[model samples]
Target: MRATVDFAPLFRSSVGFDRMLNALDLASRIPTVDNWPPYDIVKTGEDDYRIDMAVAGLAENDLTITQERNTLVVTGRKAQEPQSAAEYLHRGIAGREFERRFDLAEHMKVTDAHFENGLLSITLKREIPEAMKPRRIAITSSTTRAEEAVPQIEARKEAA
Candidate 1:
């Protein structure tokens, strides 16, 4: 039994959160999909992340990673088997093609990807642009500036 979530209240009260809400909706609808090629997402650092996928029989050339806006897509297609291949009595490792998508947060980007020991590792870094980072603004009191200027002006007038 799948529980449905209604985001009507969130949609009505929030602005500029459409992407987050859409991601939530997408996650809620993921129960029907195949869970082949299991993966793990880990936070390596404060702003760095890694996704390790268990692609047992896939080679480096069999995988393709793409980034479109805030979405990261990882696809794998196994090479065609030769006609003279030996038949296996019991086949367990999955060589089937799969496409996995990850919805990244703002500023998240794929830095690198490599395969080793039957595992595909994808590195991600959240690189917030300098313009988008939080900055401190110096606050000055107008009243203090006015008072200092008035005293200076009065002193100049008395001298004159």
Candidate 2:
């Protein structure tokens, strides 16, 4: 049994939340085709995350990782080559090209990426700007001395 969410009602009233709604919709429909090249996402620290992908048999030149705004795009394209003369009785490895996209939250930055032991690891860290971070404001008591206000001088009347 599966439950369906209808955003029609919310769409009529909510404003400036289309992106979030779209993400929710996308997440709800996660069972899509082409799930090749498995991947994993792990939270290593409070503000750190890592995405590891099992990209076996793929060379560094055949993969592309790009960060565009709040979206991360990972594409794998095998290099074109002449067909091997050797005949294979069975083929198990997947050589088809694929593209995967991941949506990241605000302030998320890709710190490092490395390929080792047939696994591609991508590290991410959230860097909040000072202006956007929460700050504490000092409170002053009413009895505290205040600076004197500058008095405004009256303008002289000109003779008509």
lDDT of 1 at 46: 99
Sequence-dependent TM-score of model 1: 0.85
Q: 1-160, model 1: which lDDT tens digit per residue?
A: 8999999899999999998898898889877567879999999999999999999988888999999998899999999877876878998888789999888899998999989988999999999999999999987798877767454333344653
> Candidate 1, 41: how far from true, in Å?
0.3
How much is the lDDT of residue 71 in candidate 1? 88
TM-scores for all candidates: the values are 0.85, 0.80
Residue 134 of model 2 has an lDDT of 98
Best by lDDT: 1
**Candidate 2 at residue 71, lDDT?**
95
- CA lDDT, candidate 1, residue 86: 85
lDDT of 2 by residue, 44-108 (tens): 99999999999887877889999999999999998996798999899787766889898999899
Model 1 spans with C-alpha error above 4 angstroms: 147-160
Output the TM-score of candidate 2.
0.80
